[model samples]
Target: MAGPGVSRRRMLGWMAAAGAAGVTGASVVGTRLATAVPAAEVVTRQEIRTLTPDQRTRFFNAVKTLHDNNAANNQYNRFVLTHYNFRSQGHGVAAFLPWHRKFLRLFEAALQRIDPTVVLPYWDWTLDSQRPERSEVLSSAYFGGNGTGSNRCVTNGAFAGWQVRYPNLHCLQRQYSGGSTIGSWYSPGMIENVLNTNRQSYDQFRRAIEGSPHASVHVNIGGDMSQMYSPNDPLDWVNHAFVDLLWAEWQARNPNLANTYNGGGAASSNILAPFGVTVASTLDTRALGYTYPRWSGSSRPA
Candidate 1:
């Protein structure tokens, strides 16, 4: 449930009361309370298309390594299970953005463990809204094309033969909504409308983005991407990186409302579940050690 009606004043009041109670942790509201990261330490997440040849090779190799590590605590399967088990807490709620922000951070950290130089790259589907199948991000050279055969198993690209462990052992799969092609996605104009229209409230903005472009991408991609275990698909990471970037862009545009969080019967101090940190802590991307590239004058990133 989402509380789009929660006002800015009420949200601020909740933060004030939390501070007065002497709440001291990453969950505390207010940007000033967030632990500051050194500028040199902060890394920028770039668009998937911008990654160089070597960068692409390293990233794909690192991800494949994680997938191949099938030990007792396999890091890759752990993420997919986490998302599958706690799917409800992260979606259709005000904490959607914050929950996924931390989710992406943890996933990125796992990748870094394999290759220190690798960072998560976002897939700006807006660039391929009209013909998603043609996007380089989904080419055989990258994430791979649509699933083939009756099982729809992906047989090309970085994760072509990946057989996910959670639930059951099955080859990674994808089914485009439009036969061989995925139908149109949310355009830049559509995302800009979401950003412009929901400036005053956190829940409003969260719902706008989540219900529109966010859901569209998942539904349009189909197959594992449309399921709770969607993280099984590597594209889930880059897709969410872009979603998280949109939330960051919204936060940047509303400096005064940076800490404004409420709705879905959630308090700012409420934990994001699984991730020990509170929702408040996940609000600041820089504090988490990464941010998207600078935004151009247009809604798309530079």
Candidate 2:
């Protein structure tokens, strides 16, 4: 096992080993990996709406540590700013999904460092698209409801009274548009269109998803959720996790193109700082050691 991170030299060696492992007929079309090395942990990321009470506790506790622990790059707001500063490169480019995948993996790794039992959970926004506010994950017992007062600061739930020191000192806030009601996000049909279509390359799929639900959800949450520092709200993790899930599903559906990377920067381009993973190494989620929960009798958003 490579532990929390792998050096570039070591990763290149792994890639060479993978290339030399085999060259089946599938390899000609880029459909399969030459080597099928298993990852040490096969963590199954579940839906946030479905997490058990204990699971929620573990998640919140890890986040609390990350938020309060100044030793980690000067608390959590710095992490949010890390993403904010590099927002352009990660979005609307070939690196969108892979960059976020690497970010989440690093964040999850950090969480595991605090509480090894915690794995990142996803939010299937479509499942609660019709009445986003009423979703179980937003209840006072969970992530809590919208903010109150002039600043629109969240005053209830796990993150209540929390202070952050990036993009100005402020409390974690959210202003649900349309009078505390978030409009419906992308439907299952829209997602199906992306999955069913022949993307031809990675950039096409990246643009499609990034334009619709991805941007839509950001606007839906408004306030801090819409800014470059969206990660200031922990819910962004689950939101992006769903995006990553979409990517994983798309990759699984089109095996031949699963490993494809095109447009924007080159494959060797660094995927932001803190994470030394190259654009190419982030292609295979299995190689990264985790996966989204598989959908059954469905193409996307189970």
- Counting clashing residue pairs in each candidate, in order, gives 0, 0
* Worst-scoring 10-residue span by lDDT in model 2: 25-34
Q: Which candidate tops lDDT?
A: 1
Candidate 1: 10-residue stretch with minimal lDDT: 25-34
lDDT of model 1, residue 228: 66
* lDDT, candidates in the order shown: 0.73, 0.69
| lDDT of candidate 2 over 1-302, digit per residue (tens) | 11112233432332232223232211121111112224467878888867788998999999998788433244465557556555555765567788788888777877877787888899887777677888877777777778788998888888887766555667778887566787666667657777777478777788677665676676566667766667888888989999998898888988888877885467767454445568788887777778887643243433
lDDT for 147 (candidate 2): 77
Best by TM-score: 1
Flag regions of model 2 displaced more than 4 Å: 1-39, 69-73, 264-274, 296-302
Q: After the best TM-score superposition of candidate 1, give how far the Cα of residue 21 lies from its true spot, in angstroms.
A: 35
TM-score on alpha carbons, each prediction: 0.83, 0.81
